[model samples]
Target: MQLSKKSRYGLRALIDLASAPENQYVSLSNIAERGEIPAQFLEQVFASFRRAGLVKALKGPQGGYQLARNPKYITAAEVLEILEGSYRIADEDVSPESRCYAVSETIQDMLIGPVNQAMETILGKLTLADLQRSYQERATQSEDMYYI
Candidate 1:
């Protein structure tokens, strides 16, 4: 299954927010700039995340957006599902009428099931906080390498 740009950008934005202290808000423009996502596109993505209850938007001078819950409580799968919709791989050959394609159909279904499960396992295990820490490590490593 191919992940769309929307999902990727949304996840990036979430990671930014996750990096912030709890109850802290980060402006959309700030997140967009930091994530390298276009402001216009991030606006739409934020709207979808808000609708999914993954984020809460605040309005005012110091207003912006924040995660609705703890980062560790939010899974990557949940974020992607909100932005990308149902995560289902299609079973192309699964048809009852196609007797000759029964084996292919069975194999397709089997493959889809395991693939879906593996995706779920990875996404479910990964949280926005995980991404935040990952980015932190990368940044630190880069800095360290630069001094070498």
Candidate 2:
């Protein structure tokens, strides 16, 4: 399954926030500009994050957003779940009385189950810190590659 725009933008914004100096609050406008995300959309995303306790916000002149906990403590799966609601690739919609019930069950058991499990394993293990490190590495590599 593909990630929703909210999830993609939220994760990118989180990475941007996580890269900031520890405990430093970052303005949503700054993150939106840096990530090329729409400010209004990112604000909505951040609102959900704040409600979910993944981020903290401050009001007033010097106010902004910051991670509620260390980046290493927040998993990609947690972020995705907060933004996307559920992580299952497919829902069990076929009823036992349906003609295609057996086929649906087989697909769920043999394909969807394994794929979901794999996704959970990967995302559950990946934290914002991991993403930040990977992003930094890519940025550094790109900077090292200059056109002739």
Candidate 3:
């Protein structure tokens, strides 16, 4: 399954927020700058994330957005669901029941079920914190190599 720009940007925004100190508010403009997402698009994505209770918005000066929960507590799957609904590899029309012919529902189920599970498994195991940490590590490594 391919993730859209919305989902990808949402994850980038979350990772940026996650890297910040706890209770720190990150403006959409800041997230957009760091994530390379357009400010307008980031705003739209943030609205959905807020409605999903994945993040909360702060008001007034020094105000912005912050995660409602710790990054470690938030899984990639949750972010994807918030932004992309569900991960669907196959459409409903592909089902044998929909086609009015069945060589093997077993085969279809076997194929679809494993794919769905694999997708969920990887996403569930990955957290926003994990992503941020990886980014930080790569940046650090690049810097270290540059000096060598």
Candidates in order, TM-scores: namely: 0.90, 0.94, 0.88
Q: What 10-residue stretch in candidate 2 is worst by lDDT? A: 83-92
Q: Rank by lDDT, descending?
A: 2, 1, 3
By TM-score rank, best first, the candidates go: 2, 1, 3
Worst 10 residues of 3 by lDDT: 91-100
Model 2 score (lDDT) = 0.94
The clash count of every prediction, one per candidate, is 0, 0, 0
- lDDT per residue for candidate 1 within 1-148, as digits (tens), equals 5789998898888888988878988999999988899999999999998988889989999899999988888998898888878776766755577776878766776887788888889999988888889988988898888442
Q: Which residue pairs collide, candidate 1?
A: none
Q: What lDDT does the true structure give each of the candidates? A: 0.86, 0.94, 0.86
For candidate 1, what is the lDDT? Answer: 0.86
Name the top TM-score candidate: 2
lDDT of 2 by residue, 1-148 (tens): 6789999999999999999998788899999999999999998999999999999998888789999999999999999999989977875899899999999999999999999999999999999999999998998999999997
After superposition, the stretches of candidate 2 with alpha carbons farther than 4 Å from their true spots are: none
Candidate RMSDs in Å, in order, are 1.8, 1.2, 2.4
Q: What is the lDDT of residue 93 in candidate 2?
A: 95
RMSD of 3: 2.4
Which regions of candidate 3 are displaced past 4 Å? 91-100, 104-107
